[model samples]
Target: MIIARILILLPLVSANKPQFPLGIAVYANPEFDICHRDMRAVMETRDLKFFNSVIDKTRIYSWPLKNFKSDIESLHNSPLFQLVRKMPKGAALHIHHKAMVNTDWLYLQTYRTNLYVCDKHNHLSLKFFKTPSNDCNWQALYERRRNPLVRQVLEDRIRRQMTMLTEIPDRSDTNVLWEKFQNIFTFLRSFLNYRPLAEDHFYQGLLELYEDNVMYVEVRSGLQKLYDLDGKIYTTTETVNILHDVVTRFKADHPDFIGAKIIYAKSRDMDHDELRSFLHETVELKKMFPGFIAGADLVGHEDAGYKLKDHSSLLLEVSNWTDFFFHAGETQNFLLQPTNLQIAIRHNAKRIGHAYSITKEPDTLRELKEKNIPVEVCPISNQVLGLVSNLRNHQAAILFALDIPVVISNDDPGLWGAKGLSDDFYMTLMSILPMNANLYSLKKIARNSIIYSTLSENEKAAALDSYEKRWQQFLINVTMPFCDYTQVMYSWLTLDRNTW
Candidate 1:
């Protein structure tokens, strides 16, 4: 009896050791494993250790931002942060177009002559007029900036109203933050509507993303007309054409960039008739600018807006070729199942943006896996918007474990004072992912962004090739200091995807 018991205990003890860790198995594809090996080798170098030490020291000085913990702010000055800025971010698929540039740029642009700010019932609206209007009590921004005493005060007020950097009110109240967030966007409309400012906005924003190593992007816009300094508005077609012109000019200067596309977004609050008209308009625009316009989305606060099922008839009216990128499951309502997520899945949405509440329904989770729907997980955006309290608890890791492809994005980086996807990438790796999440997972995430993007097959191949070359160069630069000369056999080129 004692011998039999010992034999059973021995088998149980051996069974406790997993045959393969989940992360490793999930990322065991040959192409990915090879690339990850090269990336991992560089990340483990002594140079990276020193970089991490600098980050560790700066954690104490980080600001207590409402979006992320103080420690995440600490990475702003670290060398690893610099390295991440160089890492191939693949693509930005879910960012808003107007929120792409910094607010300071808007403030400076409004200082030009003829611009006026009107305050009505504690709400501010900026407009351009030949002269001040007595009926609306319009204040000229140029005059405010000219006075030394008012200059600092005016700048402070503008920064606080346009961005979330200054004091945030009522952290516990998501409603308050949501209202404040909507107000900021409203205030920005006055400045962003100007044609010249809109042109400058696109140029500077794309340049910033290019500098931060993002090759492609799909910016969502409401397709609103841009107004001239005299308040004369351009047509929606003209507005999109203007964006294309700016993109063309930028590409002329930077040929290595894969390119950018647009996804027309309409608020979910619109009634059935309004949504039907908007859908027709979007379809017309897509025909006119087939290469530039990629898809459409229903955008707004999910909890308070109309559910996706409410527009099932209208959504089904869209052509099968047209992509539907739905923004669903962004609420924290545990009592309610994610019916919006289910609707998106049923409609065959090309991708889902911020499916934060998917964990509440297990059946939907299984469907997401079986259908292979990719999710655009914006961590900092989720935290800042009050959908999530901490990045560590974000549920993005759950998606990864379930074989749901995910891509990290900075939904509104400019509003939160982030340069590009670099900060979001760092936050996801350090705070959101599990401790066992390795370089392989990072590579897979990057590749997923490219493969799942709207880029054509030829463009995808070119982008991946470009990304691989830059990644190799980055590894060589960081690891050359401590690399052993004898261990050069597994160099980036020498290790093919077919090899181990």
Candidate 2:
């Protein structure tokens, strides 16, 4: 009797079953460049490659622009298109605030509407800075930059600088590429700090995610430092208040869009005392509103020279009280220890942001597998950071194989130069994981977004039910002639439609 019961229960535990949910995406912040979700001009151009780059083998269509018309009718009838149409991502659990707004939205904030950022000798500083000049279209930029094709040169530089991930990973001659990424963010920082500007960016980014099928966003925002339009240096608490207002307003405007669970972030440069103050702010946020501020994150270059263990005490304190949604093991080279993972396991982490280095420790990997902890996988960010040069070598691929759940995210889609959840999905499909991954597997991955999200159980169940219904309806609509669930036709006549 015991052996028979165990045999029956084995199927639930031993094997992987598909539980895919399709919901629209919701970004943590609205301003950041989130690739396939939101793109302007340059980032826009990369969408086709980003979206089609993955799952293209199974995709019935040739190019995204060519749409379905370029392919054979039979191609459109595949399970691939069905997955694409029906797949609904739950939420962007880990997006950065700077990425919530596009470079274009930031440009619009400034009086000089044209995005003519000049790069002389590969050192890019704002050209129209300190002056509100309206004669700052691409034409004026071309004349100032001197190359007859100055606008094109500047645009190419902007495009190249904006898209640092597309470049080849050459650690040898790294001066140009490394500086370019920081400079781009620095330029972005100058624009996003103004309260009004930040609000606009935040709103737009969430809208973008909503269009791409993301339901909720738990975005990371830097509160340790502020640099931009604001003269006074507001404390972390003040920053959270501003962010709360922004998200609240945005959510009010769009009833369909579920807003942010502010993941208040601290940089590695912060001292131990500063870290405590940051956590205090997070605790206060929890007191303010249950759903408004979700948790805390350790953003920035953790490998820049601080061990996560340096702040272990404070981390433990936060874990003792509040939940921690950490950016652990993001570095490909510098961070050598797995202390953060242990911390998360001990504390009972909500979800790990970018647990890329878990493969290095065999024992820790076991702990994670046993805990069933989900890792927030950011493919483009890792690629740009040179952790996994391509998606083929992504750590998330291994984690997924172990049946450890992972939710795909665009860490800084604008900074990385891609759009929407589709970009990350595309990369995971083609370069990382399995090239021949079926619709069922892809849908399961999409569903993991909701599973790993901070959403309540009831909300998740409703969303999952909606997704299943959507899939069933799509199947019926697409394969109407073939689908015979009752088998009325088959029972009445001799037929052979047993195989799909």
Number of the predicted model whose TM-score against the real structure is largest:
1
1-500: candidate 1 lDDT, tens digit per residue: 32122112221111123222453233233342223334344332122233244334344223223355333445576554565676778899889987887766766776776888776886667777776558788888777678999788767777778876663522646777777777788888767877887888899889888888888899999878898756578998999999999999999999988789999998899998999988888888889998899888998887675788899888889856478889988888645544889999999888899999898889988898788888999988888888776567888878866767788888887887787888888777666666544334465577778988988899898888787776666556554444554454355546454322
Q: Note the residue pairs that clash in candidate 1.
A: none
Best by lDDT: 1
Q: For candidate 2, lDDT tens digit of each residue in 1-500?
A: 32222122222110122222222211121222212121111111122333344334434222222211123233334333333433566678778877755455544454443323434466454432333345333233434556665645655555554445435544423334445556667766644555555566777888777767676788887753433332455665677777778778877887756557777777756898888987887788778767777787776664565566677777777675577887777655534554566665666677888878778767877887787788889886666665654456678778866777788888877664455575677556645555334434555666777777777898777666665545434334333333354542332233221210
RMSD of 1: 8.3
Model 1 residue runs over 4 Å out of place are 1-41, 44-66, 69-73, 131-135, 334-338, 482-500
lDDT of 1 at 36: 38
